[model samples]
Target chain A: MSTPLLEAQGVRFSYDGRTPVLPGTDFALREGDFVGLIGPNGAGKSTLLHVLSGWLRPSAGKVRLAGRPLRDYTARDLALHIAVVLQREEHTFAFNVLDLVLMGRFAHGAGTLGFESEADRGIALEALAQVGLEGFENRRASELSGGEYQRLAIARALAQQSPILLLDEPTASLDLAHQRHLYSLLDRLNREEGRTILVVSHDINAAAAWCRELALLQCGEVVRRGGPRELLRPEVLEEAYGVPVAVGELEGGQPLVAVRR
Target chain B: MSSPTPDRSQARRTALWWALLAVAWLLVLGLAPLAGAAEISLPRALGFGVPEGEFNPDAQILFHSRLPRVLFALVAGGLLALSGAVYQAILRNDLADPYVLGVSGGAGFGALLVLTLAPAAVVAFLLPAAAFAIAAAAVLLIYGMSRWRGPHTPPATFLLAGITLNLLFGAGILLTQYLSDPYQTFRMIRWLMGGVDVGSYRVVAFVAGVGGAASLVIVWRARHLDLLSLGEQTAHHLGVPVASTRRLALFGASLVAAVVVAYAGPIGFVGLIVPHLLRLVVGPDNRVLLVACLLGGGVFLALCDTLARTVLAPTELPVGVVTAFTGAPFFLWLLFRKV
Candidate 1:
């Protein structure tokens, strides 16, 4: 098999020294893959994402991106290759929508601090339009709705123009319709643009409907990893989640999951 | 790599800001000397058709006395406001200033120590040097304390250390004032009030030389400060070299504050007021705001110093006193105003 675009080898992490958050976790993502990471709380999903994104270092192992050790790349070089959408962001300076999005071009620009090029601004505008925020250029971030802000963040990451995108609970604050739009957007980005995406989400049905691959995490380990058809069976999910879950099919044969009450 | 051409509108916006700042500088530098306690003829101060070697008191007052004092206020105000803006951005605290970090307190203590203990003749030289050294030491102490535990010095840690240092240094200044004799106590009071009284062109030169170098370093990091203000982790995610930028910013702010304080006493509120007010007017893009702080801050102090001398002619109020009067109301308004 070709080398995985992003691979974590026996990665282990902890907030404090004594307890392990990711105890010898291993994971990998291939090029052009749209994968969903689903796990209950305290399952180390966010910790693994942090490790992969170079925000946190693994105590026992290392992550590699495109066959190079993650440690070998500087933060700027990493940002040029990977863009991330975090669960939370801060906007204390009242930067406008365009200004916030243009920051994605920070690594791309040659200016020392924040002088974005005309081309960079054009690209940022394009990204904002891509995320359906075309007219929000002048608005302050504080004025945006929660869903719009999430899309705004994605727009900013899109301006990074990176091949790999990682998101952690991107739809946590989003309403149902917004979540649906976000999932469809991700699916389109994955299918049409052939971007590699790994989203950590709690929406199992949404993941099963859109993601080509699903990984079930529990106790800092990927217990079941496969195509949705192979991994969405009732017994598989029941074991991974420690609860009985009903797995049914829609008219399109996509898996629909619900707690068996 | 070749530098990309800046966005057309952004470039235009920045240029407009620069032009406005230039106009402000010219107006302040021109009119401030005129409104002082002693008036001077503009033509004489401009040195138009005056005999080359003649000693004219009007010209002398303009060039040697009034202009130097005005210029000193400009540089000193610029440094305080610039340092405040840098502190506000880097520390992610709007209230953060050189005074908040105890830099001004250390400087006040240093000046009083020199006034009380140093020989009379050497005081002109000793006062500024001692203040600069001691103020710089206080900032270093705060900087070092914040980073002692880990690689990252969270803004909270930095502000906590600064607040603690402020308390310690404030007590030291009070003790010095208490120990001094009546004559020295009078001198100490003047230093504590923070004024624009210039002794020589040398002190102005000293402040401009050191403070100008520090200002360049701070302004150069303006872009990074924008990202860093978001949060360190996000800044790192966006590819800012967070540690180096923080280090350089702190160094620049501390040096600028110490030098200005040494030369002009611990002039308060210019740092707090100028940057905050400009941010409201121009938005908080540090590229524009930091530069604005330099020019606008100088103009502000010069005007306030003009008020100081003119408001109670012959009995000059301290420049700090004027700023405090202006800033306290602004601070209260900030607390009460609707967002």
Candidate 2:
């Protein structure tokens, strides 16, 4: 009955105004919910995440956080609420891990003079530990392996200490083991820390196995919202992906998906 | 979470390295003036126990000639390096310098225009102000050119725009030189070759006040700049007011570079190499790099200026040549090392 932590009401968006990417899709993330938004390429999953993160404006309708329109919040105010893990993270410079993660404390009024406080360092270290990067404070960010860099991104988000997290294809470049490990980290953050999460992923099996709920997006519209068992049906996925799809059940009761080709 | 004692210790060690650089900077400032063509005894230069009349030419050689030139180089070089750190952060390219971006050329063009037309009485007063105006406008021009792609323009786009402006500005400078008569053309060439013949402390104070204050503005927002260097989207998510901070830092950095160009002509490469070299010593955190570049660059240019005068006795090379010798190769390595 409580107001959703993040809500999109008929949100429509487009990089170009003439063509809408999110054609009035609707979605919501309640507190403590771990939700995956899975769709084919160009389905507007990342675009919708951008809309929700307030990085992009919706062409129509509105996104609300804590029952208020998202546009009402300043960047700092929005940052105080939602931490984001953007897609295609790049570290071209050699900023050490600790300094990079301490950037998360910026919105918290800690890095005003560029010197973070002891408390800020403590929190950044804790966030690193949460992502299993406990001893990576001095390592160069640009040199990290794919898995460590991905987790470093999460550590930066966690250092924000926000109640809601929005990640866009965090595991796109990750190996299978690292993907599952990142998902487990997300799961712990959701169940134990009581944070709300919405992730956009192309990997359906990974999403189905890890996310507590799944939303299926097709042609810029979120058309199905349910347990993975319901939405992973051959017909639903076949329509979304524009291919014949096969579905099975895992021994753990998670859905298994394969393209008919 | 484990304690980050090592990080804290490393932070302390980095502070020490910067501190050592500061000491070295002071030493360079003190010793550079003594190395010029005409030697002035230290006691006489300091006017120790000497009457005012006795201090005329000897003390003038030190206090009026060499010391002013050295201080001018220090302030100008410091501002250039400070702005270079800022441009690298905002432009997101370590190879990007105000000189390469035509910021200095634009400022120099504005000063050239004033020197050509302005009354000799007020040229000093009008120079840096005009320079800052044109330099800031040049930055706007680059930002506008890059914005056609999007709000988040790729680094290459702006760099391309800037390099184009630098080329065009170079043409403008050449045309200005061609129009002036022989005496005026020679004077223009002297300034163009980058003279630090600052005769008074007032000019040094003026450059430091304007440029040093602008450097402070960028240094104060160093964290915001570091986040921005991570990428605008990432910085925005981390709570940086991306647009406003970028604007202010750009203004501050350009102003600092403008002050330097207004006072000292096209002294190239101090800005380009100082920050790049110091980034190796301390990491790319602008909080440290910005300040380090300030001191490190002042020392670098002062030493180079000293060598300019002393390297070939009785015949001084232009300071720009010395800097180019060191910086051009380093810049080439940065550009082609991975190739």
Q: Of the candidates shown, which would achieve the greatest lDDT relative to the real structure? A: 1
Task: Tell me the tens digit of each residue's lDDT in model 1 across A1-261.
Answer: 888999999998988867898999999999999999998889999989989999888889879999899989887898898899998877777888888888888878534564677788789888988877888888889999988899999898898888899998888888888788788888988889889999998988888888899999998999989888789998888887889998889997898999977
- Runs in model 2 with CA error above 4 Å? B1-11, B115-130, B144-150, B332-339
> Can you give the TM-score per candidate against the true fold?
0.93, 0.93
| lDDT (Cα, 0-100) at B264 in candidate 2 | 78
Candidate 2: tens digits of C-alpha lDDT, residues B176-199: 888877877787777777766667
Please write out the lDDT profile of model 1 over residues B1-339, one tens digit for every residue. 222234776768777987898798888888888886776788886777688888777877777877888888888888889999998888888888867777888888888888888899999889988998888888888877767776666787888877887788889888987887888888888888888878578888888898898899888878888888888878878888888899899888989998888877888888987888889877888888898888888888988998998899888898889989988898789768999
Q: Which residue pairs in candidate 1 collide?
A: none
Task: State model 2's lDDT.
Answer: 0.83
**Chain B TM per candidate, please?**
0.93, 0.89
What are the iRMS values of all candidates? 6.4, 2.8
Clashes of 2: 0
Contacts from the true interface found in each model, as a fraction, amount to 0.57, 0.55
